[model samples]
Target: MNSAKKFFQNLAKYLAVALLVFIIVSPIYWILVCSFKPTRELIRVTPTFVPHTVTLFHYVGLLKETGFMTYFLNSIYVATGSAVLVVILTSLAGYSVYRCRYLGRRFFFNILLAIYIFPRVLLLLFLYPMFARLNLVDNLLSLVITYVGITAPLNVWLMRAFFTSVPLELEDAALVDGANRLQILFKIFLPLVAPGIAAVAINSFLMSYGEYLFASILIVSDRFKTLPVGMAQFLQQYEISWGWLASGSVLIILPPVIAFAFVGRYFVKGLTAGAIK
Candidate 1:
């Protein structure tokens, strides 16, 4: 009877985990199936999970008829650039504060942390005038600037915590070997924190990839539109064309999905590195 009870418990646990995984992945699977289906097929009375009349029409239409390809390229450039830039800036900034001792450091860093939790919408209003004065409105560069600022704080905080766990002895030994600060960072310290750095890259990529709020407000022209804003317009314009929208959306979401799949382990490691230790 005890063995029987244990078997049931194990079965229940496996069932629960399977259900959770299915829930998480079902939407993505649905989206992919819909992307390949014909519009008529997608909206059939009895929806089929597999595409009955699979067509590349949606994918081809998205690229040819709409400016989706351009939007895709813009998003890629922005996301990649933002990820690289933020990782560099935040890593450097966090390392400085985390490892170096200086005056007013705690006060300044505390203020940054406080500011980190505030609403980002506040910046849209406050910086509207400043951005207009600088002629940055509707500019991709402006998007970069906004994204960098938006991403930097939380990433810095994450990185600061990550850097705290690096053993001081490693750094001290490098210093004893007559390595300069830059040498110590690039050669020894940065390599040690590469997992955390990859995590930062993942965070920055996702933020700059799929974010809607700031992109919607800041970018007004079709020429400068990123994927999220483009998705909204594409959906509204092709409201009746479910397949097209779904395909476009699936395509739009692909990059971040690929990025996370490749570096997801690093993100998990970085997030839990100090937490467990």
Candidate 2:
């Protein structure tokens, strides 16, 4: 009876997880279907789960007719730049907080945590005026700086956790071998925390890539607009092109999905370990 009960509980858990997965993935599946379906099929009263006729018209239109490629490239530039900056600054900051003894270290960490929790909307009010004063408004560099500021604190905490888990004896041995602080950081410490770095990179990349609010507010010119902002232009005052919108959505997700597929295991491991530690 106990064995049977255990089996039933396991089955129940599996069913619940399957249901949750279906709920989350359903929208993605629908968007993919809509992307391939022609305009006639998309606006039907009843939606079809599977497309009878798959067409690449929307994809072709997005690439050939619109400024999608420009937006895509812009997103790539900003996301990559922001992620690199976050990783570099966070790694150093994390190591310093973890290893170096300093006055107000705890206070500094508390401030970071507080910033991490603070609503981003609140920061925008302050950030905009400062950027405007500096003539940084509507600039890609401004976007990169904002993204780094938003993502770095959390990433710093993640790296700090990973750094704390590194064995101090290893650093001591490296020190004994005449390795300097930078050498120890680059050669010895970095390898051990590679998973954490990957996690931070993925997080930073995704955050900047998909961020709409700041991008929309900061970028005005069509030349500098990111994917999310560019795609939103489809929903104009008069009409919405569902097909092109779906195609853009599909395209936007592809890079992140491919990235996560490669580093997913490490990302999960790093985050879980950091949280536990």
Q: How many backbone clashes does candidate 2 have?
A: 0
Q: What is the C-alpha lDDT of each candidate?
A: 0.84, 0.88
RMSD of each candidate relative to the true structure: 1.8, 1.9
Q: In lDDT terms, which candidate is top?
A: 2
Clashes of each: 0, 0
lDDT of 2 by residue, 6-110 (tens): 999999999999999999999999998999999999999988899978999999987998889999999999999999999998888888888889998888778
Q: Which residue window of length 10 is worst by lDDT in model 1?
A: 268-277
Query: Model 1 compared with the native: what TM-score?
Result: 0.93
TM-score of 2: 0.93
